[model samples]
Target: MKRVYLLVITLFLLSLNMSAQKVYSVEYANQANVKVFVVDYENQADLKVFKVKYQNQAVKNEGRWFFTDYANQADKKIFFVKYANQADLKIYFVKYANQAGWINQSKLHLMY
Candidate 1:
């Protein structure tokens, strides 16, 4: 039916929007919505993050953080914490940077 086709198209578009994930770092922790810590080991991290070069290459709320030069230009602003315990989200940096996604998808909503 035409309605079914329209629904499918709408869902596809929504999925496309949700798939755009990009992150920016704020100067101050107080200025950031999410306070994060970079773990030295992958197992120590709550989430594994990959840095994306382009903003458009990022996902909606995945771990693909794009550090904006300016705080005002950021989407989901974040701050780096010295201690893992002090962080709201603990992440590990991966060598391969592609498809800015999350290793642990549970914390995905925290970015939003």
Candidate 2:
């Protein structure tokens, strides 16, 4: 019974950590898990992103991102690409947190 309880608690904590949208911007494209492109228009984006001030506010994969100072502290490491064709994901910055979400569901796995 004690083992079962410990296992459940461990899984719950891991799920919470995995769901947080903590990101780090890498200087080199080779070091990034995903290459991102900033779109000129929101309609042209795969995801609409909102920058959150706190890491706790950036929960789940709803496009709310907390930029981490170090790559080791981040859930995902990304590199900004010069062109959309070179990107794994295309994003646009939204003014409000509520406006942040995936526009293209097909590209959702790229964030994970």
Candidate 3:
């Protein structure tokens, strides 16, 4: 019973960590975990992103992102590419938080 409680607590903590979408923008593509391209239209995007002011508000892989001041503080480091073909993920910035989400489920792993 004690082991089961510990396992539950551990899983809960890991879920919180995984949901925090803290990101850093890298200067070069080689320094990044994912290469991203900004789409002019929302329909052309793989993910619809919403920039959140607070780190706590950036929860979930649902496209809510918090930009960290330091690279070490981020969960994922990304570099913006000029062309769509050079990108691992294409994103569109959304005006509202509710509009943020993944359009292409196959490209979802790139954020993780």
Candidate 4:
């Protein structure tokens, strides 16, 4: 019984440590061929408008606001997105899969 209890406790701790968490309002920007999947909580996120200014022009084709949670597409080094309303933004670069659709995968970085 004691060993079983220890195992249960260990599992609980591990789960807690590995829990996926979202920030109050955060964005991740990466420069690579990656598929990004987002789980939005718009009401809670307090999202703002964002954009990637390329050659001094906002990529309006990308869209107006990035959104609370949605998979973003990327094919080049710079990706423009609108969160809601912010002069500056914080981005977190993460991994992505190049499958048919975006799949939640581990954090990735371009090694080369």
- Which stretches of model 1 miss by more than 4 angstroms? 1-20, 98-100
What TM-score against the true fold does each predicted structure earn?
0.72, 0.87, 0.86, 0.23
Candidate 1 overall Cα lDDT vs. reference?
0.74
Compose the digit string of candidate 3's lDDT tens values, residues 4-96.
999999999987668548999999999999999999999999999999999999877999999999999999999999999999999999999
User: Across residues 9-84, which tens digit of lDDT does each residue of candidate 2 receive?
Assistant: 9999887656648999999999999999999999999999999999899887899999999999998999999999
Clash count for each candidate, listed in order shown:
5, 0, 0, 15
Candidate achieving the largest TM-score: 2
| Candidate number with the higher lDDT (3 or 4) | 3
Q: Put down candidate 4 lDDT per residue, 56-93, tens digits, no spaces.
A: 23222212222223233221232334542321222332
If both were scored by TM-score, which would come out higher, candidate 3 or candidate 4?
3
> Residue 42: error of model 3 in Å?
0.6
Q: What TM-score does model 3 achieve against the real structure?
A: 0.86
Could you give candidate 1's per-residue lDDT for residues 1-112 as a string of tens digits?
Answer: 9999999999998875673245667778888788999888887776777887887766556566677777666766778989888898888888776533566767767776
**What is the full ranking by TM-score, best candidate first?**
2, 3, 1, 4
Looking at model 4, which ten-residue stretch has the lowest summed lDDT? 97-106
Q: What lDDT does each candidate get?
A: 0.74, 0.93, 0.92, 0.30
Evaluate residue 77 in candidate 2 and report its C-alpha lDDT on the 0 to 100 scale.
Answer: 95
**Superposition-based RMSD of candidate 1 using all C-alpha atoms, in angstroms:** 4.3
lDDT of 2 at 12: 91
